[model samples]
Structures are given as structure tokens and as C-alpha cells.
Target: MLLLSRPMAPSNVVLLLIGLHGTGKSTFAKAATGQDVKVNPTGGVDAYTKECNKYTVDFKQRRFIIIDTPGMADQNTIEENLDVLQQVADQLQNLDQERVNGVIYFHSIEGARLSGVDRDNIRILKKICGDEFFPRVAFVTTRWDRIRRSEWDPILVPRNRDLETERMKLLPNGPSIFRFLNDGESHKAVLDYFAGLEDGTAANRGDKKARRSGTG
Candidate 1:
């Protein structure tokens, strides 16, 4: 079966979004891509996004191609996640500089700390992308508007610190962290970081495709 709804053009800068279930991958995708994506509300309770959805937009004279992948979790079974990963892996191999640009990893404050599934998913990501892919990854904590600074000291601060200290090892040298759905333009800031890396060329290491695990 085809993973993408439509054919990806050569000029698209593909950005893959992955995170734990309920991390608001869909919400962030909608906000960042400016596309009214259809998010399942009932069956969505588990996978939310049953399949990978691609949204294309124009940003800063460059095409912003966002691939919103299904959230990874245990409830859906390891087989389910693997199936999606296989499709993603197969698709990425065909894309060049016009392909994958970076990874946007989403986390949430609703949890007391990152869960086991979260850690497992990160491991899978590392396996697929390889160590060098770390620099292109962005670790983002979404849904920050749920609380205020006063409410964070006893709750969100320790959690955040622990994530950066231990959990962030998912990305080598620790990928840059950001607050999405909280501060305005934070999403743009991430894309901007990659944009600056352009250096008037996309043929360098900056444009190289990420490594993926063999599927099948």
C-alpha cells in the first residue's frame, strides 16, 4: 500500500514528526503546517493518526513538507509501529536533499515524567536514523499552555530537567529543545535553524538522507 497520499515533488523539504501517543503530534502538525488535518477522535484514542499524512506548504520561499506520522505506543502493539516504520524507511531511501530535513520529536507536560513507551520509541528512532541524525532532530515539549510558571516549580520543572538530563540522550549531544504551542514562532524557529544550515546549497552533509533500518 502507498504510505503517502500523493507523490512528493523534488523541491519539498521533508520533515518527519514523531512522538509518544497523545503527545499532540496531530495538533502540532496542524499548527505548524497550517493545514486542517482530520484527526480521529474515537479510534484516534489509540493510534489517533492511523496512517502517515503529508502536508505541503510554502515557507520563506522554500516548500515545507511535513510528514505527520502515527504516534508510537505499546497499546497499538509493536507490530503496528514497525509496519509504519517500514513504510517510512522505504519512502525515505528514495528522497535526497529534497527529502528529509529534520525530525520534530514532541513530548508533553501532562505526564509526571517520560514514560517507558516514550523511552522505547526513542530507541527505535535512534536505531533508524543513526547517530549522525541527532543533529537534525528537534526535541519539543508540546501543550505548554496547560499551566503557568507558578505551577511549574513543583510539577513541570523537575520533569523537564530529568528529560534534558537523561531522556534527551535519544539525540546525541542532546538535540535542541523547544516549547511548542506555548511561545509563538517556536516552530518557525526550528525550521529557521535548518534554513540557516542551507549555506546556499543543499548538496552537503546537511542535505544527506538519514539511515533507516531495513524493512521486511
Candidate 2:
């Protein structure tokens, strides 16, 4: 689970990546951490990551301790999911900062609508990170590469809007949202937003337009 162990950088940011299975949590973790980091392959219905994983990724002169957690709603029983939630809590508490700098919640644009499982996952995430952390959160939509190039304008834009709107309602104080194309620059766009937050450049609810413009 420890992808890299090295001397800490100047600024160490702890980020929690949360979402359901197949939402590209591991993919992002492996890419951001490094190509050498061994991450579980993404596929199928069941979740491959069974517990919380911690990876150290250096980007733009910042060190990000990414805690990639198990997919919500993958467990058969509510009690089992609760146990995973406890695991996430434990990891957060164990951090040297004892606080998370930001949270990235992933969802696949492939699903046209948010199902019951999706809502349930969001609810569980709220419990894990708490309401005060909402402003530091980013609701990211992934798998844009799956859509055809010709449909990018017509299909991709509107879908992103709908997804953003829907997630806004679920999260309080309006956490910034962005699309993840599964690439490096896109990854930096997300990190840049959180980095801004860390440095006091971005404020919750006030810089919504600035956040969207940075990614757009």
C-alpha cells in the first residue's frame, strides 16, 4: 500500500480519493504516484481494492499523500461497508497532519444518472470526511476517453454540467467539480486547484468560477 517512501517534500498535502469501483481511483493513484507504483487493475463489477492504500506523489514541487480507499457499495452488507468507513477514518487520524488537505470524489460519466448506489456512496463519504471538509472537496468525472471524439462537444459538455449540478445538490457549500480525462495535464489541473487552496489562493464558494476556469 505504501507506494513510495522518501524524504518528505517542502509541502506535504494529504488528499483522500473516494468513489465506487471502476471509477478510476487506482488509475489516478498509480499515474500520480509514478508508473512504478503497483496498483490494482480496474475492471469488472466487484471492487479490487479491499482496504485503504497510501501513496506519495510529488507534483509541481509538492508532495501529495494520496489515500486511495475501497469502493463504496461494493460490500454486500451495510456492516461491512461501515467497517471500511472505519478503516478510512483510521487512516485519516494516523496522518501526521491529523487533517486532510483536500478530497477528490470520482464518478464515471458513463453512467447517465446517479443510481441508488451512487447516492449511498456519497452519503457514506460525508460520514467519513465530515461536512466541514466539503469545501475542500472536488467532485471529479472520469473516463472521458470512452466517449467518441465526435460526441465530445454535444454529449460530453452537457453531461458534465448535469453531473456537476446533481453533485452540487448532494454536497453542501458547493465543492468545485472538474472532469478527468485520465491524463497528466488533467491530473495537474486537479492538483493545481488543491494547491491553490493550500496556499490561500482559493476560497470555498467564492472562487467557484476561478476553479472552473482553471480546468476549462
Please tell me which predicted candidate would have the highest TM-score against the true structure: 2
Tens-place lDDT per residue, model 1, 79-140, is 67667677666655544322466777788866666676667666776776677766666677
All models: lDDT? 0.61, 0.67
For model 1, the stretches where C-alpha displacement exceeds 4 angstroms are 1-11, 40-44, 76-80, 90-98, 182-184, 200-216
Candidate 2: TM-score? 0.79
Residue pairs with clashing backbones, model 1: none
Which candidate gets the maximum lDDT versus the true structure? 2
Candidate 2's error at 94, in angstroms? 7.0
Provide the TM-score for each candidate, comma-separated. Answer: 0.73, 0.79
Q: How accurate is candidate 2 locally (lDDT)?
A: 0.67
Clashing residue pairs, backbone N/CA/C < 3 A, model 2? none
44, model 2: CA deviation in Å?
Answer: 1.5
